[model samples]
Target: MRTMLVADDDPHIRSLLRQVLTGEGYQVLEAADGLEARERLEAAPVDLAILDVMMPGLDGLELCRIIRDTYDIPIILLTARQQLSDKEQGFLQGTDDYVTKPFEPEELLFRIKALFRRYDVPSLDKIRIGRVLIDRRNYEITAGDETLLLPVKEFELLAQLAQYPGRLFSRSELIERVWGLDYEGDDRTVDVHIKRLRQRFAEHDGSFRIRTIRGIGYKLEAGNA
Candidate 1:
């Protein structure tokens, strides 16, 4: 079953969303605040997210931006603020849909289904460039007949660079985008992961190459993607 997350500080709202979403055959993950929601996001792949706008910790708009930056999941914002400006800001942050407070459960369900209909692309999980293949859903990499499982951090870093091939991501931008800004470690952590990735790809005789841009970070150069 596909997973859905509801990040709302109110117990009643969370319970209501969970019960209804579970009844519709989705596995619902609940978070009382934005931090927990982000933890859950890092831990697994969620198909969709329903976020309450006025939560403690990181508010929904910010959370939406973070999710958009890292994950491919669709997001729907739950808010009591009905102002046009508020809705515009939410959209500017990359939310797919918005549901104001005191919303009908059926309406939310309909929106969720509509998103599935729109973005449920079959190839969203897989990336192939020449002899290399990365499956984001299964966390598996295929090089010819040999298949390898990559650690979560390494896999995410590779996927991020591969998705935006030729884009030069700075070290700081990569750290904040791939590993979250809360990471206290120095920017060299990205260098470590990149070194590990390069070693692994060499062992597998991968076709695509991740090239370092001197002072800039890295970019993926696929020969015949």
Candidate 2:
């Protein structure tokens, strides 16, 4: 049975999440705070984590950073603060999604399912094409002697393309895979990210190219011999 760890100080929130996730056929593990959550995580591995941002000790943001740095588990940060900066902080800390408090249970469930689907898909943690080396877990991409820290979305998109060199992905497909299938956004989002990635590669002597097929999508060129 797949396990999910819920870390929140609120009794009602924990109970509600436990009930909902249990009904969805997940083995639910509950923690009262970030400290307890860490203990639970260390005791055993879980497939995913749902963390509250305002815990008494360690807090959700700090916990998310610890989990991300130590493990590859997907995390959803729950916060009462709905500011864009809050969401950006969670993303920078390696959270897969940010859920505001007072959110619909169904929405949370949907996000969890989306994360599961993505996690089950095959991915490459370390991909090397020519001089560029991508460590997806560390969120670092290196070309030649220069190492760059990529924004969350850029790293994920690049990793997806690097996973299958020379394979084409439609803009819609890339958006679905990297940004979640339920993401409601313009295809221009993909284009903008690709543009940024190209700039990063160019800074390192243009070691590799991400090919754009007109009206199609994008592909990472195979490494030259």
* TM-scores of the models, in the order given: 0.60, 0.56
For candidate 2, the clash count comes to 0
Tens digits of lDDT, candidate 2, 1-225: 678999999999999999999999999999999999998876654779999999998899999998876566679999999899889999998999999989999999999999989978867679987888999878998888889898999999989887766555778778888999789888999999999988877755445688887887887775462
Q: Residue by residue across 1-225, what tens digits does model 1's lDDT show?
A: 678999999999999998999999999999999999998775554779999889899999999999887566789999999999999999999999999999999999999999998886544688886787889899998888789898898998998877755445678777876899799999999999999999988854447888887776777777653
Best by TM-score: 1
Local accuracy by lDDT, each model? 0.85, 0.85
Evaluated against the true structure, the overall lDDT of model 1 is 0.85
**How far off is model 1, as Cα RMSD?**
11.7
The regions of model 1 sitting more than 4 angstroms off are: 122-200, 203-225
Clashing pairs in 1: none
* Each model's Cα RMSD: 11.7, 14.3
Candidate 2 Cα misplacement greater than 4 A, ranges: 125-225
